[model samples]
Target: MGLFEKLFPRRPPDADPRAYFKTLTAYQPVYTTYRGGLYEMALTRAAIAAFARHCSKLHLEIVGDFRPELAPVLGQQPNPWMDASKFIARLATIYQVQNNAFIVPVEDAAGRLVGYYPVLPQQTSIREYGGAPYLQYEFWGGQRAAVELSRAGLLTQHQYEDDFFGADNRPMLPTLQVMRTQDEGIVNGIKNATTIRFLARLAANLKQKDIDAERKRFAKDNLEGNNTGVMMFDSKYADVKQIESTALVVNPKQQELIRESVFEYFGTNEKILTNTYTEDEWNAYYEGSIEPFAIQLSLVLTAMTFTPAEIAQGAGIIATANRLQYASNNTKLNIVTQLFDRGFLTHNMGLEIFNMPPVEDGDKYYIRKEYAEVSKLNTETDPTGTTEPKEGDNGDHTGDP
Candidate 1:
């Protein structure tokens, strides 16, 4: 037996590729003090929520003369199970949490591509054999299956030593820890402030049993909100005070600091979370965060879905966000008008920019009559030394005279 076979026993050809022996199973990740698993990390850290929301809202589109039949499947809806937006949202969450997203293509019996199904990063494993990596998928707690990379689609924003997987956001451990601590402190402080405490004083001559009875009576009567007033003898004294908490005041500063850090880590700003960004800031944010992801997703989708010949024939995929989403109506109108007036954009193209159907002769480019070449302008001026009207000016003089 070869070394590859020795390391991983080969499965029977007829056996289901999704089934694997227990011995071949890989180790699962455990929650750590600094970070938890995918779901836990998202739940505990506010940064993940911001990242997911920001990425999910950004639109995704495929741009290219690609397969017409595959458009509905890949562009409009990734699968019958979910629409394109939902699929992208799920993919974005997976990418942010694990830094890698894997999709399995579902094909019909005729071998035509139908839909794509996303697999959780934690539920999948990568194994190397004969110097190449193979993906292993696990489900229902123990069932394992191996899939070839060609059959599976993968998207990764950051590359790592392991070719099969991407680098995770584990480096943010310290920041996450600080944020977690701040959150816990704020929660504890709020709890303390909401709690009620009592101070009681008893007469020195009072018996121990009488003191105990008084304490019990105070607890039974004063603890509940129903007892607003309490009757006490001269020997017994009690006062109820609400715990003064600094959390309401102190936590805001810490919370703001944490929010800034979280937004910075995700390459977004507070305006995005607050929905208060100006037009210019929103454009910059889209360029920095949303555009890159869309481009990467387009490249991966094209490569996985199209053949070399098809790609060579101008067949590819591209993800584009709606311009209206980032820019206001006035901004879009100005841009389109400027480009069109300068002859940089044709009428049809301008119409397309507004998502309107092109009309006849819309492909023609027009320039303003006042914009003439410098040489043409020079020719139009009089070359004579004196600026005097010559004979036949305006063709009113008669040559016969």
Candidate 2:
């Protein structure tokens, strides 16, 4: 080993006792929306109930259909052919504003709501296939009209939502018309899309489960649902192409792990750990390690966990560094050196105030530059009026601002 390497050989201290149990085990939040317009949509009453059963076993909250009023709203105007398209557009507007519906709080074994998934109705077709895209009706005029008007109107154009102030934060789904046109015979395309999105969201929420229990539930739920002949398929030139379909969307076990981890991070309350740290420390950690690790680990974990990982990963790092700084044998220089030498610690992991990872030759880690100039704005000395007693001014205080 080189002199610098040997001199700075990393040591394994008791990595905070809290960290041993923080193995990405928390449940993340997820939601699923189903469309029931099609007779053969996979999200049948029985299917949804079965999916809910599996979700319960994995600590995932199940959100059923939100668009139950679709038919009522569309059929309200007494025009199924022309006004139907306009009605679908209005539904899209409502969906864009509210973003989600039917928020289900996923609980841990202790019945604490760690994360939430909100189910919505499949209001738009996400499927783009063949010469005639399934969701094409909303974007352009269907067979009767030459130009595809906005689903609702020009005011609520889908492209308008593609801006910085747009509703991309809101999720979307396929409208019944889009689904019907995409798949002839009104195949359960809406239900399938809703189910797929829900599963994807669920997979992005929790991880780690009681493997045996999860597997058993998976098998049971798969069999419990009727065949129903609801299949996920791709349409090619008006030809039906069946895609592989599974009863369960995500691995129940991985989701359990992520959910467990998030729960631990959130503790019993629904609050994230970001509020637990002092503001300065919070800024330092976020700008340094928290954001980086959260981005990196999201690859292995779910979106639900990504939220907490961004909040909690810094906990262990901060605690470790604090403990080392307190030990007499460990100084700031030594701590920074050991931290850098650790294989898992990335340069951008926020190791500053000591020997930070050298800035790359042509990289822009910071653009505003003012962050570096942030003087320690001591709250103790700010002009909130002296918290400490002033000379002879506090005993007989007269109130005046």
Candidate 3:
């Protein structure tokens, strides 16, 4: 009914899931637990989200003229179902959380690579079939598919021991447990501070029923909204003391340790997660987290999308971003204004630095007229326009030329 719906309609329920993973072998019903379940935690989710958001902003450009037919699909929109932002965001999130993510080619009716998509299955494994390596995917609904391992791209981290997959988050469990303990301590502390308001010693002469009635009466009279901050009590109690309530103060050092654990593991810092990072911190975070991901994604996609011959001909994929996006406005201004006048940046490149679209013939390079080759400068004449006075003439340059 809406314009957006008309443009990007939802997939039909009856459509086959093969739109994602193109299988070359029989499906498997295997169901294995994935270790990425830790992404559901708060800090883990925050780290992944921050990483994915920045990664999604990167531009996936297909370099060279090798795969002209598939360039449009792979560059802006990996698949018809999702745009570049959604596709890259989902891929980055999966790669960061799972430590291993896969991208398989989506073929057309003629078996041509039309688009590529990340297939996130509940279980995935590499199997050998007919002397060839095959990658298998098992979905949560018990659906499964298999593809040639060479045709699929894999991005992995913590991949020291396993030949095909990355290691699990076993070492990080202790740090996570410390975080859990701190949270529980805070919760229990708050319960203690807020639950019991007063401690009273009742007179021993009162009967059990009288004591119960006195307790209820005291609560009804003093705890009700009608009563002011002043808590009033009768002579039924021998002694009474108001409990002091204070906030649960977690140890700053312990909290810092927990934060450092997360930051180190994710290769990020508090400023990056909070979006208050300086230019230096942003560059560090980009190189540590985002640049590596872009590099890996570029290499994997290039290898998966092209043959050895094509790659040898300089046909490949590259993921690049305007690292200046995180720089301060003044820095960006300097980059655009300074670089533009020197012909260091083309018209489109200058516009792109500010995230603007190119105009007609925007690829042309322009430079200021004052800039010229050093060889072209006249060495004989004084550049100041006053001719040097001859030895015989008085030191006035206007006398002779």
Using lDDT as the measure, the top candidate is: 3
How many backbone clashes can be found in candidate 1? 2
Model 3, runs deviating above 4 Å: 1-37, 205-213, 225-235, 337-342, 367-401
- Model 2 per-residue lDDT tens digits across residues 1-401: 53222211331232111121111323211112233342243222222222222122111111123223222322333122224233333332233333222212233346432332222332322222222212111112212111111111111212242221123222223332333343442245445654432121122223357534543454354434537635332221123233455433334574455444433321211112223444354345343433332232222113222234443443111101222222233454565465554443445443433434656542223332222222322222325645444355454445743
Candidate 3 lDDT score at position 344: 87
lDDT of 1 by residue, 180-217 (tens): 67667778877776654555665465788987887777
Question: Scored by Cα lDDT, where does model 1 land?
Answer: 0.62
lDDT of 3: 0.76
- CA lDDT, every prediction? 0.62, 0.29, 0.76
lDDT over C-alpha atoms for residue 116 of model 2: 26
Cα-based lDDT at residue 221, candidate 2 = 47
Error of 3 at 367 (Å): 4.9
| CA shift of 156, model 2, Å | 27
* Cα lDDT tens digits for candidate 3, 1-401: 53223321332233223332323434432224466446867887899899999998988888888778776786678887888888899999888877888787776656677777876777876665555556666677775566777888888888765566776677778887787788889999999899888788886687889878987778787787544778776676788898899869789998998899888999988888899989989998889889999999999989988899999999999999889877878898999898888888888887777778998998877888665446533322357765454456565445544
Task: Give the clashing residue pairs of candidate 3, or none.
Answer: none
Model 3: residue 164 alpha-carbon error in angstroms:
1.4
